[model samples]
Target: MGFDQYHEPPEELSQKVRTFARMITSLIEEAEAIGWYEQRISVEKDPQARAIMKNAQGEEFKHFGMDLEFLLRQKQDWRAELKEILFTTGDIVKAGERGEKKVD
Candidate 1:
């Protein structure tokens, strides 16, 4: 996603902008989890794989930062919920990779 993709806000759109902020944060959270696992698995002291994952993770961080800035500017109250969801998703991804069974 590029800065050019951001459209100018209309004068009367409040609720929808809030919803878009939430959606973008959720998408970024999912992406961060995926990148974390890819980084964790691509090992073997292989410089190439390590380099690739490093760049990918950095991009994910950039994405997260963008969403965070939007949230701060548009929906500060939603930040806590979004952060918790991101951390929970990361934990789930890590557990699944480890073959850990989820307890009902």
Candidate 2:
């Protein structure tokens, strides 16, 4: 069969797609946590912490970009969910640090 005939994936292939989506979601969560940790380190007055944070941020960014590229290639609708999770995590971290615990 050609491309069109193979377009409708079977149930097993669908499961694989879901698994890939979940994997990307996990990577996004990890990247978000690393980003937040890097931010916290950057606020430190010590030069060593600042340097560590800079390196951490770079690594996290690379991971984030890779995950995004994979998600885009998969053409899944979970992209918004991943974005929301990262944004929510960042907001929560910021709010808790301020003792406000507010989210938007």
Candidate 3:
């Protein structure tokens, strides 16, 4: 089966675009791993197993952040929106609205 990241022909895509697609795929995998660990930790009966899952999840989440940072660096508008939406105290919806306005 073909990779989901490439909607178009791979031969037609530039190397930079392919690398970006790979990174996006990686980011999705990291996020999925974090969610999976959360579910496992929630249902796990053993404290030690849950602790290990939590630690692993923390690492996965860190990878997710790094992936997001990489994407932000590549996209100026996204970087601007995230700057407004993240680390601000208030209604989250309001922050998102403000962030959207920032790009427009």
TM-score against truth, every candidate: 0.43, 0.49, 0.94
lDDT order of candidates, best first? 3, 2, 1
Candidate whose lDDT is highest: 3
Question: In candidate 3, where is summed lDDT lowest over 10 consecutive residues?
Answer: 67-76
Per residue, candidate 1 scores C-alpha lDDT tens digits across 1-104 of 43422366544557677477566757667576667757575653877777777777777767767766665566554554344445454575564434332221
Q: Runs in model 1 with CA error above 4 Å?
A: 1-21, 24-31, 34-44, 76-104
lDDT string, candidate 3, 1-104, tens digits: 78899999999999989988999999999989998998999999999999999999999999999999998888999999988889999999999999999999
Q: What is the Cα-based TM-score of model 3?
A: 0.94
lDDT: the better of candidates 1 and 3:
3
The global C-alpha lDDT for each of the candidates, from Candidate 1 onward, is 0.59, 0.62, 0.93
| TM-score winner | 3
lDDT at residue 20 of model 2 (Cα atoms): 71
Clashing pairs in 1: none
Candidate 2 residue-wise lDDT at 47: 84
Better of 1 and 2 by lDDT: 2
